[model samples]
Target: MMRTTTNSEITKGIVLKAMPYKENDQLVTIYTYEFGKLTIRARGSRKLTSKNAPSLLSITQGEYEITLHNGLSTLIRGTAIDYYQNIKKTIEAEIIANYLLEYFYRYEEENKPSLEHYQFLAGILEALDIGYDYRIIYAYINCFIMKENGVELMMDGCVVCGNHHVDAFSLESGGFVCHEHMHLNDLRLPKEQLQAIRYLYKCPIERLNELHLADIGPIQKIFEYYVDEFCGVNLRSRKFVKSIL
Candidate 1:
């Protein structure tokens, strides 16, 4: 048997992050539509004259040529498709976009292709670039992440009594609770806000442009608490977004 270093392939992907490897090299993590997540090494990408540098930035979508090896793949070359310059130019959108990129980077498994995840990432980036409300996008993605992890919040009726009228979101019950069943500390959620959250979870990412919620803070907090309690992972980027809001 012989080992080969020329197992090369081409794929379309978005750069999640890039870290300096050697003095003039980089290790780039990319989530591809075809191959899921890949870490490719780019030699001399740190130099100002490097052609591969522009296509390697975070959130840049491009077509890449990679020489796959057993340990780490090497980047042969790439061409940029979308820079998402609109997202990079706006600070708030940039933060939320980074948060999204970090979220996927942390949760998405390597070499496991998920068209759903890839499409969701690509759609959200496009929506953000188009100047949709970042808060609504964040709220929507929170529900998405929670649902994908099997910790989806029960939004239809009270998790306790099945009552149509719900008041507060009870972390203990993992869903809405009527006034009779709500704990002393449960946060009271208004009917409109409750409906909004339900809509967010069910709404397609592409249709987000047609909807808007003036205040997403309350709903966002509910999903955040749900994720923290059930998922057991807290993202630091979430806190950064919270601080500025």
Candidate 2:
């Protein structure tokens, strides 16, 4: 049998991170919408005269022309379509965004991964681009955890008692519960806030802010604990993010 090269066109992607290599070469990890996340090294992108330096630093919702040869992909040319101007200036957003990027880079399979997760990376970038709410970012992370892992969280009723229009929540049991089930290790989730989380999980970008969260700390902590301790996603960046704030 003989070997042949395969080439294809990909939709668009964001540069998650880039590292300098050799004298004037660089390696970049990109989270793409159509193809999930993958790494493509630029031949000569480390020097001042190189064109890719700007693109490497230009992450967050940036779209580009990714050329794939055989089983390898390279950034032939790229342009920053959505720069996410203030994502860096805002420390909290930057930390959370970078943490999300780290998760994508660390967990996503190079060749095969869920494409929706890739789209999520772009969506989060867009969300951060528009505003600087850390709570919103946290909500997105929780929703991402559920969506990516194929875990369905039923928020309508208690896992133990089948209560509807519930007011409290339990991470252990999944979601909302009635007063009789308060001893089931579920946290007290207010109705309005549970509605906000529900909205976050299902609503589109335009309607995310409709449910104004007075305080997302408790909810965020609950999901974070569940994600890190129970679900086994221990991101060092998450630790760092916690240490700072």
Candidate 3:
């Protein structure tokens, strides 16, 4: 049996990660705006003379020409797009960017395109490039990712009893629980923290800078637990970012 090759398609994407393939080739995982995540082999990408070399680095945003052959996509050409030069200048920014990229790479199913997810990711990178508060940016992106994946936190009320005056969050229950229904191990979030989580869910990312978040520690912990418990994603970049902070 012979598999016919598809015509080359062009897309805009960011390189999530790049690894050395056989000899001069490079295996790159990219999150494209039009086609979602793809693992494509870039032939001779490591060579000095290769035109695609610059756009093959992890975190580089570029236009890619890909052709599907025998169930594998190969990179025919790449033109550098943003490169996000500002984000690469600082270690903290780089770590945060890497963590976000790694999170997407781990959870996003390949070839399932979501324009919302793509725009959310691209906007986050742009935010990081322009030097917004990274912690808030991280929390915002996490909220968007969770929402897009349909695991958004149940913030309306108690997940168990439908109580509007919820006071605790339960990792086991996957959302907020009323004081009466709260288990012994459930996290008791302060009133402000609960409000903050709700705001993150409702507010747009562009308005993130307007928020006067006193502390995001509790909010971060809640979402981190949610993603770990539900998605089973354990990102190395997450640990690294935490260690430095």
Candidate 4:
């Protein structure tokens, strides 16, 4: 008996990263709109004359035609759609763009299809290319990922008492705390900052221009810490991003 494999199909996605593989090949991880994350082997992509080499670069969004197999998929060819060159031209945008790619590469499961995740990532990358504030975009990404992973901090009301009048944010408690329920040492943020976080969770990336935070540092730090503490994964690129900021 012989096994039958899936036929070749085209997927549109951004190349999260490509690792050099055995002599002249590369293993490319792509987050696709139809098939979620996929690791495809690109034979001869490392060579200078390889036509697929340009399309396989990190952060390049394109259509990839691949033939699926039981073990691993092979990339037949790719056509570049957008290079997002503007992001590569700026240092801050570039670092944040890499961080965004790293986030999806770390969290998204391979072969699980999710249109929502795909669109969200695409929008973020587009925003970076258009010169949006990287700090705010980074914070937004952190907020969205935490919520998707079921570790989102509550901002609507008190996590403990359900009081609408909250005075502080508690990392341990996992959300805002009402003054009545607040611990003595609970971190206090201005009321505006609290509102900013609430908006961060619900607002789409395209509407990011409307959101203004006088100082995004504190809230951004909170989201980063929340992810580190609750999600239980240390992003390797996070330190470099932080240093440059």
List per-prediction Cα lDDT, in the order shown.
Answer: 0.84, 0.70, 0.82, 0.85
Window of ten residues with lowest summed lDDT in model 3: 1-10
Evaluated at residue 28, the lDDT of candidate 2 is 82
> Residue by residue across 78-154, what tens digits does model 4's lDDT show?
98999999999988888988888998898788888788888888898899999888888889888887888778567
Ten contiguous residues minimizing lDDT sum, candidate 1 = 1-10
Candidate 1 residue pairs that clash:
none
Better of 1 and 4 by TM-score: 4
Cα lDDT of model 1 by residue, 181-202, tens digit: 8889887876778778778878
RMSD of each: 2.7, 3.1, 3.2, 2.6
Order the candidates by TM-score, highest first — what do you get?
Answer: 4, 1, 2, 3
Candidate 4 Cα RMSD after full superposition onto the native fold (Å)? 2.6
Higher-scoring candidate on lDDT, 3 or 4:
4
TM-score, each model?
A: 0.91, 0.86, 0.84, 0.92
| lDDT, candidate 2, 72-130, per-residue tens | 57776666666677787777778888888887788777756555676677777777777
Winning model by lDDT: 4
Q: Which sections of candidate 3 miss by over 4 Å?
A: 1-6, 148-150, 158-188
User: Lowest summed-lDDT stretch of 10 residues in model 2?
Assistant: 1-10
Instruction: Give the C-alpha miss distance for residue 224 in model 3, angstroms.
Output: 1.4
What are the runs in model 1 whose C-alpha is more than 4 Å off? 1-5, 179-183
Clash totals in order: 0, 1, 0, 0
